[model samples]
Target chain A: MDFRKKLAIEPGSTVSLADINPEQDGGIESKEEGKEKLSGILDEITPLQEMLYAEKKHALLIVLQGIDAAGKDGVCWHVIRAMNPQGTYVASFKQPTEVEKAHDFLWRVHQRVPAMGQVAVFNRSHYEDVLVARVHNLVSKQVWSKRYHEINNFEEFLTENGVTIVKFFLYISKDEQLERFEKRLEDKDRQWKISASDYAERDRWDEYIEAYEAMLSHCSTAHAPWYVIPANRKWFRNLAAADIIHRAMLDMQIESPRPTVDIDEIYRRYHHAVREA
Target chain B: MDFRKKLAIEPGSTVSLADINPEQDGGIESKEEGKEKLSGILDEITPLQEMLYAEKKHALLIVLQGIDAAGKDGVCWHVIRAMNPQGTYVASFKQPTEVEKAHDFLWRVHQRVPAMGQVAVFNRSHYEDVLVARVHNLVSKQVWSKRYHEINNFEEFLTENGVTIVKFFLYISKDEQLERFEKRLEDKDRQWKISASDYAERDRWDEYIEAYEAMLSHCSTAHAPWYVIPANRKWFRNLAAADIIHRAMLDMQIESPRPTVDIDEIYRRYHHAVREA
Candidate 1:
């Protein structure tokens, strides 16, 4: 199955978060099977990423957005880590600083977008403006409402300029979020990841769902679509995100540029150097 | 006199490079008068720059394009230096490196554009993709022609996002360029800047003028218009550029942002610290 087509939120279609199942596993029968598929997909991604770096014709931007403990960081560790670090960068957006708040919302985000031959992963991205900002009334409705249009224009501009953007909305049920929160508390190794605010935010789950639905419906453009990933099962999320990213890289069709110098002349010079040595 | 109005290439207008006098001095009678005016404008600009940095509402992007010895560097030294270096940056775009050539023409340029509350002066910029690229036949007509639209869209996008772009085509006569080149050879301090290509490029002066005229005509838009500064007289170039830049900043109307904290509460805390000390 082409996960890119299967998972993507259709452009211009309304999305109801309740209708989608978070536990859907893309037909993988078990966690071990999913992990095996993820590993294979990751192996395929390494060379494709190198070709992407060598070609330097296109940039890949992977945006991951979800509620607390929806595996945004997990996708980075398990899926994105497969790509070479030299050509890939991860930018995380949290609360805006004074300097960032002073400009238009996109100013800080634009600075972090990848250049050609690179992949940028946004752990929590500009979507937070709509998701978190909308849920908390951080800005007036008039302000945040117009941002949907601005974001579409910005994404369209990036796509036209050879950036391929794949946004993943890591979907999880409310119960799954509570379960993950409890797991974080139980695991001393994962205690740092737990925060009191994570539980507090659960109270606004419905509001957040409304915000996410609006974001998915409005900002999903043909050039840059949002993918709703079933992320209740961590292993399945990793496998699906890895598979989708691998597919996107393949679609770029990147190839090394034609040699600008005379290969024969360079080869002759190299032989002369070897003889002298 | 509004130098911005006098110097700007009207949007949607054709340009005749020969028709505009490169020796035009903006009606300033002597070097002393122009220098004095420039100095006054520079002084006024310092405070405005602080407010700009504090407000963080708008960014200033100044693009300088000119032939060799047309005083592109002179404008930066004499005018742009007036702004605080903390908030100002000078990015010089020379020959594209192998890595830069790998990406789209605008990729490197986009990365260097100013963020909010900052000023960026491009010593030589994306116009080279059109000017030098066209005059030297570095790219085909089809490739270079499409860039005019691309550049306009890029500039429009920047403007919509609160960047005020002021592009200056430092206009100079062929005789003036030759004179300046000779001066460069004569002055030991300036001898390093003298290049064989400078003389070679002069042979294509007419072609370059055609290329530049096309650029000015096509890419000049309402949001980011091109200013053809008469640069034969170096002092006048400095004066006209400084004056125009001052006018543009004034138009931005950047006031310091309202304090985000309570002044009374902060004062009380400050007093408490002082009392404890």
Candidate 2:
């Protein structure tokens, strides 16, 4: 199945969280089968990512947005990890400090956009201003409402400059979130991830959903589209994200530039250096 | 005197290198007077630069392009040194490395553009693509010719995003360049800067002048204007550049953001912490 087509929120189309299944398996029978498919997708991503670095013709920016326990971190570890770390960077946006809040919302975001020949995965991004900032009333409606158009313009500018942007909105149900929270509580290694605000934020789930829906409806564009990935199932989430990324990279059709120097002259010089040694 | 108006290349207007005097000093009587004026300009810049960093509202990008031995580095050391080191960066563009050559000409340049609240000075910039590359026939006419429009669009985008761009073309005569080369040879401290290609490049001075004139005519826009400084007089060059930069930054009118937290509440909390201690 073409996961990109299956998951992408079409430009100018509104998305309803209730309509999409959080438990989607993409026709895979079981956990073992899903893991195998995910491995295959990761394998496909590795070589394409190398070509992306070698060709240096295009940059790829992957934006991940989700509520707590929706597997944003899991996707980064399992899916984006396929790319070489040398050319891959992950920028996680948490609460803004005084310095970040002083500038326009996109100020910090633009600084982290990928350079050519690289991939950048935004753990949370400029969308947070429209998401958390909107839901929490951190900024006035006048300010946050204007950002959708600003974001569209910014993304279009980046696209025109050879950055291919893919955004993922990880979808998970409240029950699944609770389950993950419970699992975190049981595991000592995951205990650090649990915060008192996690439970407090869960109470405002409906408001966050409304904000996410508005973001999807207004900001998705042909140049930088949003994807709603059913992320309750970890294996399926990894498989879907990797598959879409690999397809997007393949679409770039990056080719290494033709060598600009005279190969024969370099060969002769190398032999001379070897003789001197 | 409005040095910005006097020095700026008007958009869409062609320029002639021969018509402009590189020895013009804006009526400064001597090197000592010019140095005193430059010091005053630096004093004005220090406070404004501090406000820019505190406000975090805008970025400043200064591009310096010139022929070899034309005092680009001197301007960086003497003029730009007035700004605080914490908020200032200087990126010197040398010949492209193999990795850099694989990407578009602007890719390496865009990576070094200032972040919000910062100042970035490009010692020699993307103009090299059109100047050196065009003069030497490194790229075809079809390729180099299109870059003027590309550069304009790129600068316009940066300006719209709150980056103020100011480009300088340090103007010097052929005879002045030869004199500087002789001075460098006599000064042991400057001997490291002397290279054989500096003299060889002087032979193609006419071609380089044509390329620079074309660059000034085609790329200068209202948002990112180019200034041709009279660099034959080194002290005058420093004074002119500093004066222009101070004016441009003053125009930004950057104000520190309002305190986000309540001072009274912070004061109470501070007292409570002191009592507990």
C-alpha lDDT of all candidate models, in order: 0.84, 0.84
Q: Compute the TM-score of each model's chain A versus the native chain A and list the values.
A: 0.95, 0.95
lDDT of 2 by residue, A60-119 (tens): 999999999898877876787666554666777879889999998889999989989889
**Candidate 2 lDDT (Cα, 0 to 1):** 0.84
Q: Model 1 segments beyond 4 Å from truth?
A: A1-277, B272-277
Please write out the lDDT profile of model 1 over residues B76-150, one tens digit for every residue. Answer: 667875765546666779899999999999999999899898888898899999999998899999999999999
Clash pairs, candidate 1, are none
lDDT by residue (tens digit), candidate 2, B192-259: 45555675688899999999999999988999999999899999889889989999999998775554
Q: What number of clashing residue pairs does each candidate have, in the order they appear?
A: 0, 0
**Over the stretch A1-277, how does candidate 1's per-residue lDDT look in tens digits?**
6788889999999999888999998887788988888888998998788678767899999999999889887787678766655466677787999999999999999998998988989888888898898889999999999999999999999999999999999999998887676565444344445444665688889899999999999999898999999999999888889888988888898775554443334324422322111
